[model samples]
Target: MDPSVIATLTAVVSAVVGGAAGEAGKSAWGSLTALVRRRFGTDAAVTAALEQADTRSPEETTRILVDQAHADAEFERSLADWAGETARLLQYKHDVSNTIGGDARITGTVIQAGDISGSVNLGTPGPPERRG
Candidate 1:
């Protein structure tokens, strides 16, 4: 199975604020079953998916790593991975190039990270060097 499919599915599965990973755990199985049925015989597919909801099954449980625990982090990582994969898939379509011409430039200076938030602890200050 393509890992990107798992990643996309994982992102969707974890989108809810409070959700369980394996709640409706049939998605992966269903997709696999469909694929096998399309390619091979029903008997092979049936044998492949001997049990629908077996706890010991690695295929059924592997998705949990991406879908449940530390979901935000995992989903973000998965998203980045999938994005890279998609970019690779579309590499031939759009060439990656720097948009700014050699002479083109921004007139204003670029600001650093801590240059925006004002001050959190404003006890001592004199014409601040940086915003935060």
Candidate 2:
């Protein structure tokens, strides 16, 4: 299985699990299961794995994804594609409000809009800055 695919699925699974806790978790889990069913309808193994993930803990769901990926190469590839697409779709659906990464600092107001298609980059311009 491709490492990138595995990584993508891992991330998607984590996001799904993170939302599997309270009243909000219930709603999040429901949405996730619906996505899985809609995308992989009639696939017995994937369907079974998704069912298990829904009922089991997040760690268990991660284990299931990894194990299944190892067991079936073709399926693993499909899962990676599905996971990447699903994650993107979910982000759009939820209207990703904010995202921050690395040690970059933000002290001023920042606004971003993705009307149709747009990208906002706040990374340091020019050469990388050295840190003491």
Best candidate (score: TM-score) = 2
Per-residue lDDT of candidate 2, residues 20-125 (tens digit):
2234334555665675566567678666776776577655675666676677676566566667776665565543345677997989867755444665676668
Model 1 TM-score (2 dp): 0.24
Q: Write the per-residue lDDT of candidate 1 for residues 1-132, one digit (tens) a residue.
A: 357656554343232111222322234334433533543355542334423325324444334333432345544454445434433333233223335458867876543341234654534466857756
The superposed Cα distance between candidate 1 and the true structure at residue 4, in angstroms, equals 13
The residue pairs found clashing in candidate 2 are: none
Worst lDDT window (10 residues) for model 1? 15-24
Among all candidates shown, the one with the greatest lDDT: 2
Off by over 4 Å in 2: 20-49, 95-132
TM-score against native, each model: 0.24, 0.45
Provide the lowest-lDDT 10-residue window in model 2. 20-29
Model 2, residue 129: C-alpha shift (Å):
32
